[model samples]
Each structure stands twice: as C-alpha cells, then as structure tokens.
Target: MEFDKNFKTHSFRATFITDLLKEVPIHIAKDIVGHEVVSSTEIYYRSSLTKKDSLKILNSVDTLRFN
Candidate 1:
C-alpha cells in the first residue's frame, strides 16, 4: 500500500508506541521510549486515541455477574 506523503519514519515510531499503550502500562511504554517522564510519552500517546477508540475500550469491559 502506498503511504501518505506526510508519513515519515517517526510516524511509524509514534504508531508503534501508541499501539503499545493500548495493551501495556504507560510506564512500560515510557521506559521503552526512554522518556524522562510519562507525560512526555503521553503527548504522543493521548493523541492516538479517538472517541471511537474510547467507546471500544469501554465496551470491552465485562459487566459484573451476580453469583
């Protein structure tokens, strides 16, 4: 597939880190990227998530079952 002209190598890094944040802890992602602060990593991290993404996450939560 042809990539958008604006896409760059750093874009791949951002995408990779963003996907990692979805499945893993933020601290883990911070260490992986060697960021001095989680907030620094968060700048890239937060932008990746969308409203639909938030809904998907919320929907994935299993409702409490009464025993």
Candidate 2:
C-alpha cells in the first residue's frame, strides 16, 4: 500500500484541530493542539460567515422560546 502526495501529517493535524474547534472553545482547541499562542489556532479555524449564513443562525436563535 502506498499513500499519495495529498497524504501529509499536517493534513491530519489540521483536520483534528479543525473538528475540535467546532465543538470546544478556542482556548481548549489551542491546548489540544499544543500551541503556545492562541492566534495560531485561530488562524486554522476562523471561518467567514456569509450574510445568508448569519441570517440562518440568527433566525434559529429567534425561534427559541425560553421559559
């Protein structure tokens, strides 16, 4: 068995950190990734939200009926 050029250690690291960031806080993600600086982790997981995407999230929030 052989791996291709797309297979790199950093790819796995990037994916692992990216998935972790989605569920956990940035500080925790930074600790899991073992970065001394949170900025580095922020660079990996920062996503730009489109207007439509923002509206969807806001609409979801508005639909919540708190007791």
RMSD of 1: 4.5
Q: What digit string (tens of lDDT, one per residue) describes model 2 on residues 44-64?
A: 764557889999998888888
For model 1, residues 13-48, the per-residue Cα lDDT tens digits are 788888989888999999988998998887775365
Model 1 CA lDDT for position 47: 65
Top-TM-score structure, candidate number: 2
User: Which stretches in model 1 have alpha-carbon errors above 4 Å?
Assistant: 1-4, 46-67
Instruction: List the candidates' TM-scores in order.
Output: 0.58, 0.61
Sum up the clashes in candidate 2. Answer: 0
Which pairs clash (backbone N, Cα, C closer than 3 Å) in model 1?
none
